[model samples]
Target: MAANWMRRTFVAAACASAALLTACGSSSVDSAISPDRFVVFGDGLADQGQLGTSFTVNDGSVNNWTSQLAARYDVKLTPASKGGWNYAYGNARISQSPDAAGNASTPTVVKQIDTFLAANKFADNDMVVISAGVSDVIANTMAFINGTITQDQLMANATQAGADLAAQVTRVINAGAKHVVVTGTFDLGRTPWAKQIDKEQLLTQVMLALNNRLKIDINPLGGKQVLYIDAAYQVNLFQGNPGAYGFQNSDTAICTSVDAGAGIGTGNNRVNSALCTPNTLLPNADPIRYVFSDNVYLTPEANRRLGEYARDIIVLQW
Candidate 1:
C-alpha cells in the first residue's frame, strides 16, 4: 500500500516537474561554458582513491565517472587529501554516519561540501558536482533485509535521504556556485546485488522513492545554473543495450575481488569494487566488454561512456 502510494506520488511529481527540470535525452554539444575547476562530492562512483582505490577496476585509467568527465576538460581530478578537488570517498552517504561499508569515519557528502566551504569560496568558473545517494540506498536496503527495519520504514528513510540530498544541493547553489551538476542514485535494481538476492522489483521501488523525490524537490529552482543528470535513465539505456555500447556483458561483474569485511554495505565477504583491479578479473573476462566491475560499480569502459554522456549534457545545457 505504501509502495503504491509513493509510486503514484512520484509519477505525479515527475509529470508536473518535467518541464522545469533538464531533459534526460540526447543534447547537442555546446562549448560556451568553460569551468576552471570541478568541485566534486559524493560516494564510490565519483571517488578517486580517497580510500586508496576507487570503487571500480583501478587500472591507472579514468575508471570512475567523475574522473572520466574531468578528463574531457583536461582537468585532473585527484583526492582532496592529495591536494586536489575531488572530495568523494568510498561508502560515503549524503549526511549519514557509519557508511555503507560500516565505517563511521567516512566523510559524508555534506561534510565534503562543508570542508570545501569552510576555507575556500566558489568562483564563477567553478563547477560543483554532486553525485550521491547510492550508498544510502544500499545501507538502508541491507538493514531491511537484516530485519532491522520494516519495508515502510525503508521507504520513509529513502524519502528522507532524498530530501536531505536536495537540501545539500540547494546549499551549493546558494553558496555562489555558478555551475552545478547534480546526479542522484542510479537504479540499483539492475545491479548484480539485486539479481543475487532476487529483489530487483523491490530495489527498483526503493531507488525510485529516493530519486523521484529528489527530482521533484529540485525542479522548482527553474533549471538555471543547476542541471540534474538522470543517471538511472542513462544506466538503463546502456545496460539494456550493451551491444550498442560495445559491451558484451552487462549483467555480470568483471572483477572478482571479494572483501573480507563489509564491502559495499551488502555484507562481509561480498565482491567489493574498491578491491577490484585488472589483476582480479574473472577468467576470460575483458574489462572493456563488461559494464560492471562488481555488484555495485561500473567498469572502466562504461564509466567513460557515462562521463562523455554527462559532459554532453553539461555542454548542451550550460
Candidate 2:
C-alpha cells in the first residue's frame, strides 16, 4: 500500500512539474529521467585539452569529429567543466592513478568519474562517451615481454581493468545515467613503436585479450541504456587499409618529437601531445594526414576519424 502511495505521489508530482512520464509500473526502474547533456571520460584519444594541451588540437580537433558527434545530439563537448557535463581529460587509465609514476599528473579514469559525480547526477537522456584501458594494457604487456613480470601477472591486470570498467558502469547507473557508451582501446600493438619490435603480435594478442575480457564483463550489463564500441575492430579497420582513411603511413611517427622509447625498451617516455604542434616537424608536414602524431597517440585526423566511427556506433545503439 505504501508503494502505491509513493507511485501515485511520484506520478502526481511529475505531471504537476511538466516532467515526462517516468514511472514504469515497478520499483525496479531507478530513474526514467533522460538528460540533455553529454558527459565524456577517458584518455588522450577522447580528450579535448581537459588535462592540458591536447594531441588533436594541432589538426583542429576542437572543430573536428567530436564537435560533429555532439552536434547530432545538439550539444558540443565542453572540457574543464564541473560534472564533466562535457569532455574530461588526457592520459586517463582504468587501473592507474593520474599520480602514478608516469602519468604526468593526470587523474585515473575512476577518479575522474568520482570527481564528476561528486558535483552532479545523470539522467536517461544524458549520453556518456568513454575509451580507456590502453595504458594498463601497455604497462602489463611491457612488463611481461621484458621478463619483468609474468604472463599470469598481465592476465591479472587485464582482469582488474574489466572489473574497474564494471565498477564505472555501476557508478554511472547509480548516478542516473541511462546511455553510457564505453569503448575499448584499439590494437595498441599495431602502433609505430610496437611494430618496431618482434613482440608486436604478442602485444596485440594481449591487448585484444584485455578488450575481450572487458567485453565479457560489460555485455551482460547492456540494456537500452548502455553501449560498448569494439575499438580494436574499428582501429584495425583503419590500420588494415590506411588509404581508405586518406593516410599513407600508420607505421611511422608523423612528428619528429615522437619518442622512440614510448612503451618500448625503456617504457618511461610519456606522450607529450603539447610538443606536437602542427608543422613542428618538416616545414611542410601535414599533421592531418598521418595516423600518429607521436609514438602511441593518434594524429588529429585519426582522432577525428575515430570520433566519426564513435558517432556511428552511438547511432546504431539508438
Candidate 3:
C-alpha cells in the first residue's frame, strides 16, 4: 500500500511539473500586474505536499501556512519545500549541484531561490519567508542521545544550520526581496516521537538553544529590509494545554490506523513496527496533543497561529 501511494504521488508531481513547463514555454503573457510573489523554503512543517513519491507520510490536503497567508494577503505563493530536508541542502549545498534533473526530487532551498530569481525579479514590496533547521536538530539529537554522535558535533551542526538559514535570508535580500522573514525552530520535543524516545526534555533544550542562536544571528541582520519572526513562541503558547485551547480529543492518537501511523512516523520516529496496534496515547495522556495529524504534522490551529505570525511580520503590525 505504501509503495502504491508513493508511485501515485510521484506520477502526480511529474504531471504537475510538465504542466508548469508547458505554461512557461507558451508565448508572451500578461506580466504587468507584477503581483507580490512569496518564495517559501523549509522542511516538513512548512512543506505543502512538495515531497515526491518516496515520502508518502504527509497530511493530506492541508495547505501550508504559505498558501494560507498568500490568500489572506492576495499575493502569489511559490512553495519549494521538501520533507526531511535540512537547511544545508536548501541553502549552502545546492549551489554545488544546480542541475534540476539530478536534484528535483529533493532540490535545496538555495536552488529554489535561484529559480525564483531567474523567473521573476522581486520588487521592493516582495517578501521571502523561510522556515528550516528542525531536521538538523532532529538528526543531531538522535545521534547524540543514542551516544553515537558527540555533543560538540550536535552544537556545531546546529550553529551551522543557523548560519545557513541566515545566509539564505541574505541571498533573498540580494535578490531584491525588500521584506525577509526568517522563522524559528518549533518544539519538536512535544511531538509523539519525542515522547516515545524519552528524549523530550533534551530535545526541547536543544531546540531552545538553537532558536536562541538563530535569534542572535538574525537580530544583527535586522534593518529596514530584513525581519525575524519568532514562530516558536506562538506554537509553544498554542500547545501549552489542548483543553484550554479548545481541543477535545487531544489525548487520543492523532492517527487511528496503520497508514496514519506510517505518515506520522516519518517525522522523527523511524519505528515501522507496531503497525496493527496504533499508538494513540499522548505524552502521559495529557489532553494537549502538540502534534496534530497522523502524519505527525502541525494541526490547523498551529498553522493558523504561524500564519498570524507571518501576517504580523509582513504587515509590521504585530
Candidate 4:
C-alpha cells in the first residue's frame, strides 16, 4: 500500500509539475538530494578498478558509469580494495562463481554486499548503487551456445539471476539503505560479442526475459526509497539513433587491444577494454564518438551518457 501510494504520488506530482515525462524520468536537472557517499556494487560496467583497471578504455577519462555518477554528486568513487566505497569488480555475477571472464576469484555481487554490510552501516545520506546482470546474461548465453546448457536452462538461469538481483536489492533496502538505485542487463543483441557468436536474437530474447523478471520482481519493492532504471531501454535509445546521442559509430569498438587469455569470457584472443588505452585505439576512429570500447563494454563517452542519465533520473524523481 505504501509503495502504491508513493508511485501514484510520484506520477501525480512529477507529471503535473514537470509537464514532460523525461523530466519526471531522466532529464538533466540539479539534484536536491545530496549524498555523503556512494556505495557501489556491480560488474564490469560499474567497476572502478577493483581488478586494477576499469572494463572500459583507460584514457584517464571518466570511464566507468559509477565514477561518472559520483562526479555528478561531487564525490569521487574508489574501489573497496583501495579503501573506498565502490566494491564492484570485473565480470561479477549476482551470486554465481567463475565470472563472465571465467575468473573464479572475482567477488560476486552477493559477496560484495556482504563485505559492505559487515564492515559498515548505511547512512541516510549515502546512495547505494547496484548495476549488474549483464555478465550473468553473457555467461549464461555463452554456456548455452557451447552446448553446456540447453536453451531452457539458459532462459531459466537468466530469470533466476534477475530474481537473485532483486533479492539482493531487497536485502540492502531492508538492511538500512535509504536510497537504492538498481539497473538490470542491457540489450546484449546489439553488442559486438553477440555478432561474433552469431547469437544476437537468442541473446536478445534471454536479455528481455531476465529484465522482465527483474522488472516484475523489483517493481513491488519500489517507492521513493527504491528506483529501477531501464538500462536496455537506455541502450536501445543510444543505438537505435546514434546521431542523436553524438555517437558516430555505434556498432564498432574504438580500441584494438586484445587479451591473449579468456578475456570477458567470450573466448581467448578477444578485445578487453580494460587494457585499451589511447595508444591502442584503431586508426582514424574517434574514441569519444564510438559507443563501445570493446565487444561487451561501452566507451568512456557512452559511460558518461549513462552515468548522467542515471544521475538525472535520481535527481528528478527522488
Candidate 5:
C-alpha cells in the first residue's frame, strides 16, 4: 500500500531529532488558497454533491442546518454542486481513503489531489477545504494507550500525521489554490470512547499538540489565503456548554446497538465502536443534547451546530 501522507508527513515534520520542529513547505506554484466569488465546474461537478446537503432524502435534508448555514451567507449552490441527492460520503478521511470500517471506496486525499492535478489546476476562486488527521490520530492514540507504543513515540507519529496533512495543503497551494480551509483535528480524548479519565486527558493533550504543531508549520508564511479551523477547541467548548447550543446530551451517544460491538477487532467499525443508528430513544433521552451519534461520529444535529461554530470562526478569520 502507498504510505499514507499522515505517516509520511511525520518523517518530514520531525526532520531534526533534538529540536523537533515542523517542516512545513508550501508548493512552488503561485496559486493562493483564498476565495473569490466565482463558480468552478469540474468533470465530477454533477456527482460531487453539495457541501451543506445531507445524504438522506427522507428527513427533508434540504432544510438541515448545513443548508441553513449556507443560506444565511447567500451561498447559492445548484443541484450539481450540492448534496448527492442520495447519500453523502461521511466515510471520507483527510489523508487516507475511506475509513477502515466504512462502506466507502473514495480515493484518499493524496490520490484525490493527484487526480485533480491530472485534470485541473486550482484557481483563485477554488477554496479547497481539507480535513483529516483525526481518524489516523484516533487509531494511533488508542494503540499507544493500549500499550502498543510509548507517549514520545506517539508524539513523533502524530507529528508526521500533522506534516502529511500540511504537505497536502501545501501541494494545493503550490498548484494555484487561492483559498483553503483546513479543519484541525478534534479532541478525540473527550469523545465518549475515552470513558476513562486520566488516560483521556493525556490523549486530548496529544491532539492539541498535533494541531498546534500544524498551525506552527502549515500556516502560510507571507500569504493570507489559508485559514485554519480550530476544530478541537470549538468541540471542547460545545462539550462544556451543551445547553448553550441547544443540546441536551453533551457527553454521551444517542445512537447505539447491542450487536454493534459483536466480534469487534481493532478497526473503527460499528461493532468495535458499539454504535447503533436507531432513531428510537428512551422517553428521557433527547438526541438534541447528545454530542455523538456513535463512539466517534457526530449526530446530524451536532454536525449542524459544529458547522455553525466553524462558520463563526471562518467569517471572523477568513
Candidate 6:
C-alpha cells in the first residue's frame, strides 16, 4: 500500500509539470509580438530634420509627420528623410550608390534607408513606413514649371517614380520587416508652392498614378501581412474641410516673421498669404509669409494632418 501511494503521487506531479509547460507554450504562441521599433522614410512631409536644414526659409520648427506619429503611438522612430527625396533615390541607395536626388535635387529616400539599416537591425515585429514620390513629380515637372521641360518628360518621370516607389517597398519587405505600410502621396497642388508651378492638376494626376502603381505592387503580398494606408484619402478629408478637423485657425500666412504674432491660423485654416509680398511689408520686422517658416513649407495644420495619418497607420486602434 505504501509503494502504491508513492507511485500515485509521482504520477500526479508529472502530470502537473506537463500541464504547466503546455500552458506556457500556448501563451507564447497566442501573444502577438509587440512592435517596439519603427523605421520611417520619405520626403519633407515625413522628414524629421534629416536634411539638417529646412528647405523653406523662416521655418524654425523641425517637426514632421513621422515625429508626431511616433509620439502618438509611443514607439521609437528612426527617421531617414530629406526634403525633396523620391523613390528612385531610395532604390539607388539599396542597389549601387548611396546618393540620389529626388525632385527637389535633395538626397534620396534610399540613402535614408541605408543609413537606418546600417545602424540598426530590424526584428520580425518591426514596422517601416514609406512616404515618397512627391519629389519625383516636383523634379520631373520642373521643366514644365520653367517652360524648359515638356509634358512628355513629366509623364515619363512620373511613371518612373511609381516604379521606383514600388521597388523601394519591395526592398523594405525583403529586408525582413514584419509589416510595411506604403502611404499614398498627398495633394501637392494645394500647397503654396503650387502657385509657383501652376500645375496642381497635373501634379495630382502624377501622384494618383504613382499611388495606383504602389497598389499593384502590394497586391502580391498577402493582405494580412503587408498593408497599404490610403493617406491620400485621409489627407483629402482634411483638405475638404479643415475646420471640421480642428485645424480651422492654424493658418500661417498671418504671421509675417518666424517669431511674429500667435502664428498664422488656428489649427485648420489654410495658410494663404498670397496677397502678402516678400521683403516689403510686415507688421513686424520679420517678412516671412505663408509657409511653415518662409513661403514654401507646410503649415502647422498640414503637419497635423500628416501626423494624424501616421497615427492611423502605426497605432492599432487610434
Choose the strongest candidate by TM-score.
4
Error of 3 at 110 (Å): 2.9
Instruction: Give the Å shift of residue 23 in candidate 6.
Output: 44
Which structure is stronger by TM-score: 2 or 5? 2
Model 4, 68: alpha-carbon shift in Å?
1.1
Native-referenced Cα lDDT, model 4 = 0.85
Decoy 5 TM-score against native: 0.68
Better of 1 and 4 by lDDT: 4
Best by lDDT: 4
Q: Residue 310 of model 1: what lDDT?
A: 77
Report the lDDT tens digits of candidate 4 across residue range 1-318: 997799769755653343233323345577879898999999988898886888888988888888988888899889999999999888999999989978889899999999998879999999999999989998998898789999999999999998999999999999999999999889989888888878889989998888888878878775678887666766776677787677888888788989999887778899988899889999978887888999989998888878877776677677
lDDT of each: 0.84, 0.62, 0.51, 0.85, 0.50, 0.50
For model 3 the local lDDT of residue 113 reads 69
lDDT of 5 at 235: 68
Candidate 6, residues 193-303: lDDT per residue as tens digits?
A: 454446668877777777777777777885455666665655555445555454442223333434222111211132322222343233553321122333334544455
Query: Which stretches in model 2 have alpha-carbon errors above 4 Å?
Result: 1-35, 63-68, 81-84, 98-101, 145-147, 258-271
Cα deviation of 152 in candidate 3 (Å)? 2.7
User: What does the lDDT read for residue 17 in candidate 5?
Assistant: 19
Candidate 5 lDDT, 9-43, residue by residue in tens: 64333322111110111112222223333222111
lDDT accuracy of residue 63 in candidate 1: 82
Pairs that collide, model 3: 90-109, 90-110, 253-280, 264-295
For model 4, the stretches where C-alpha displacement exceeds 4 angstroms are 1-28
- 136-174, model 3: which lDDT tens digit per residue? 566567557667778887777666667776777778777
lDDT digits (tens) for residues 1-318 of candidate 2: 997699558534533222111111112222333337777777666666664456443545453345555655557666754333544455567747632225556677787788777877776667887667766676676667778888878877777786787678767877787788887777877887687555677768777677777777776676476777666765665577777667777776676644444421225554445456665654566765677776667777666566555555454345
lDDT sort, best first: 4, 1, 2, 3, 5, 6
